[model samples]
Target: MRLLIVDDQPLVRQGLRAVFAGLDDIIVAGEAAHGAEALELVRRTAPHVVLMDVNMPVMGGLEATRRICAAGRADPDRTLPKIVMLTMYDQDEHVFEALRAGASGFLIKDASPQQLADAVREVVDDGAMLSPSITRRLIREFVRRPALPAPDGELSALTGRERDVFRLLVQGYGNAGIAEKLTLGESTVKSHVQSLYRKLGVQDRVQVVIYAYENGLI
Candidate 1:
């Protein structure tokens, strides 16, 4: 896959390039120092995926992702490149904002070279990735936070089965995983996922998960 690297630090981009240099399936298409340059690179190279740093001197990764995704959504036939954000902030309060901006994954800046490579591959494969530490912190924060009543009667709108599906989904189960856990067919799980989306007024799993957490639904 053709990959573009976006980070303010040249050394960080160099290290990522070195990590991909030895890999067969992954190739470094280009590098950029900020989100604006990254957008220009994407226009020229049309890379399959982008490794983005959350904070930068000029435009930030989150804003870039939002613009890229918005443009793609405007064209029905276009398939925009996937984005995986890299950051040093462990608290990562911007994670949800990044998701709202269309990021597919999030990674720690300090991840090992191999972990970085694996993240690139995972996002290329159309999967979501989150650093283990950030994942734990996010889950704990939502689970232990003071319970807030679900807004706009959204929680009450779900059927019992849909609620069951939502519960497991927020727990990080994929469609097939949730299917097996619920003893339902994979297609059934997908249908339930769609139903959850419609009822809860969400676009994707990330939004659903956040909604469930913020509203104390899970």
Candidate 2:
């Protein structure tokens, strides 16, 4: 997996680069001190995933994420890069906004090297890296809010099995977990997941969670 590290601190960037150095499968594509440099590197290197710091000088990670995602949308031929925000707190206010800005997931700034590596792989594999604590916090926050009106017949478009898969996915179950829970094969669960993605017009698991929360389906 190719990765670009975006942070304002030199030590943080160096530390992350060292972590990935031990992994044979992952390559550190480049490093940037801020969001503007990140954008320039992104265009030049075309990394598969970007490890973005939430707060930075010149341009913030949120704005950079918005721009990167927007660029992908503007050019269908360009593959969208998955962004995982590095944050100071799981309950940080910017976490949700990062998701809204098109970030794939988040990791606490003090996450261990193993956790960092795992998060990178997860996001690249089309999974969201929301830990249990983060998931619970998201649920709690959404519970206090009023639900947005879902588009006409959006939920109805899903079949019974697809709905089951959707619920499990929003609950943070991966394909293998969903298969075990529903007593189906792993490949079958993946098929249902892709089907759900297609019907819901979502690109990844993070978007699925956002959709469920926004429509009051969770």
lDDT (10s digit) by residue, model 2, range 38-128: 9999999999899999889999999999999889867867988899999777764787888888888888888889999999999998888
> Where does candidate 2 clash, by residue pair?
none
Q: Which prediction has the highest TM-score against the true structure?
A: 2
Q: What is the Å distance of residue 50 in model 2 from its true position?
A: 0.7
Model 1 agreement with the true structure over 1-218: per-residue lDDT tens digits: 99999999989999889989999999999999999999899989989889999989899998998888877767646667878889988655777678768787788888888888887777665457788887787777676788778786777788888888888888878888889999999889889887877677664566677777777666
Best by the lDDT measure: 2
Q: How accurate is candidate 2 locally (lDDT)?
A: 0.88
Q: Give the alpha-carbon lDDT of every model.
A: 0.82, 0.88
The clash count for each model shown is: 0, 0
Evaluate model 2: give its TM-score: 0.87
